[model samples]
Target: MQECSPPAQVAGRTPEKALLSPSRARYGEGMSRIDRPALGILLICAGVTAISVNDFQIKLLSGGYPLHQIVFIRSAIGLALTLVLLRFEGGFAALRTATPGLHLLRGLFVVAANMTFYAAVAVLPLAQATALFFVAPLFITLLSIPFLGERVGPVRLFAVVAGFAGVLLMQVPEAEGAGTVSPGVLLLPVAAAFLYASMQVLTRKLGAQASAAALAIYIQTTFLIVSALFFLVAGDGRFAEHTTNDSLRFLLRAWHWPTPEDWPLFLGIGAVAGVIGYCLSAAYRLANASIIAPFEYLGLPLAILWGWLVFGEWPSVLTWAGSALIVGAGLVVFFREGARPRPNRAARR
Candidate 1:
């Protein structure tokens, strides 16, 4: 999961204000801990590593199964894991909220983002797909201004422009002899990035109204519902044909019974989702966004490693250059945010 809003400002107050406000008191316990930047970094790193593994497994399974079936199985297992954690945290009551509409909307975005991302990865090299998705933070910064009422300084705006430029560079076709990836294919991940960013913005908006675990459960529930619907509607015999193109095949393929050998990988993806989702939400909860945000770039390198070692795919030189710009621009925005002083409570209101 991407970093939603800044933890402190999620509920429209500082930690001190959160503690004093009765409605915000329950939320404060999750947010008021002493900042531990190192722990935040470790947690984020672990979270991303788990997500990468899940991606790798999805890619491996894409050949044999439809994307929706894979998602259904993975999400079903993940939901079970989430419910167990929710039970320990506060059970059903922890999930109660006045923002049910926002949760449903956020869940819709999650479904769109995950489905598009998986579609992209099914066709593109893992490194390339991951790099494209890294644009989410840029999208978040752009979205935050209107959605969260944050002011964007000129520096952050420049970073955003530079990051889009990087995206363009990555998509540009190589010289005559070099391999050419379809522009349409590249756009899927970009779309996913936007939806993911939108979902994060909503998450930030709801952060004060809900616990991290509750927010996570809602997302998992959305996944379960969407995936199940897709599986049921598209699982018919008419769509069973396998095609030469992996991406289309992944999207249009029909559901099939999972083999004994496939059960573990499917179940493992669910466990990974539970762990990654919690760690990500918790990491943002534990530290300032700027302090923990940069660590997300760690996913790019990990994607490269997996693409190379597992899939025998390496990003081209152009991909690396473009990735560098995107990563650099995101870090610049985060650092700038950190340098600004926190707004006064009255100012935030």
Candidate 2:
């Protein structure tokens, strides 16, 4: 799934290549012809909505199906959709790349991150899991220091520290009720976010070396392989028994044949994933990352809405407080980065 932010720009490129080359350019000529900021905002909103719906469907299926089985089916369908789109763009030629190792490493991170997040959402409230996932931007900031050689000033450093504090607050028990959350469960999404941030860092590293389509194909292929292995190992006799732990059961549950009535829902997930992935890439292409990145927080409210409508869950007081700090800290990093000066055209070459 496309996450909250676009990868940072690739380092060291000529001005002409940056503006004219399809792989190097932020958006193609068609997208550049429009009002970029406005179009970007709209696309980001649509992308966020599509992904939220996808998560809702995944959460619904998680109750009855094994996590790996669901990923296999969803990703297999999604890969078919991606291939159809790829044919229009340039067939298999568009997927050609020299950085196969980097792509595979990035794909591994994607698989780990998606599996962890799926496990988290299977047991936790959607809003709560999503809120914790927002800390990814903070993780990205820290990872960039070493992986991308980006410098962090004091203000952004403070944001990182405060953002983590928000994570801690989220785990605290409320005054009126006994905490229903298992402490171990909270770690799932946190680890997912860190892995996701690491994946984004790798995305930045490979942004110039590969097209977005190519990167996506690599990740989906990894998903297919990993999920299939899980299915082969656990889908047969293993599912004959049941586990009491919701998270463990979600992870290890055996694949059963989907009922005839439920086929459309499973297929629809692939379609949703396709749209979400496209819009996110398109959004970044159309406008500056700073302009569109903050809108990603829209996921939180959408999660709350779906949680209430579908599962009758609401955010607790601590959830609200924690979300505020997390969102505020993310905005701080975005704006600070936006305000920094960029190298001149001549310097870029």
Provide the lDDT at 128 for model 1.
Answer: 85
For 1-349, candidate 2 gives per-residue lDDT tens digits of 3433222222221234334445443324321333377887898888888778888898988877888887788878877877777776567887776568877887788788888887888888888888888888888889888877788899999999998988888887771111765787887878888888887777665453434455557777888899888878887637536667677788888789988877877998878766666567666655666667788888889988999999998888888888788888888988887676665222211
Give the clash count for each candidate: 0, 0
TM-score attained by model 2:
0.87
Structural similarity to truth (TM-score) of each candidate: 0.88, 0.87
Model 1: per-residue lDDT, tens digit, 1-349? 2223111122222434443443334654433444666887788788888888888899989888888888777777777787888876667888887668888997798788888888888878888888888888888888888888888889889999999998888877761112554677788888988888887676565454555677678877787788778767767635546555556778778778999998899988889888777777667666666677777777888888999999999888888888888888878877877677775322211
What do the candidate models score in CA lDDT, each in turn? 0.72, 0.72
lDDT of 1 at 210: 54
Error of 2 at 45 (Å): 1.9
Worst 10 residues of 1 by lDDT: 2-11
Worst 10 residues of 2 by lDDT: 5-14
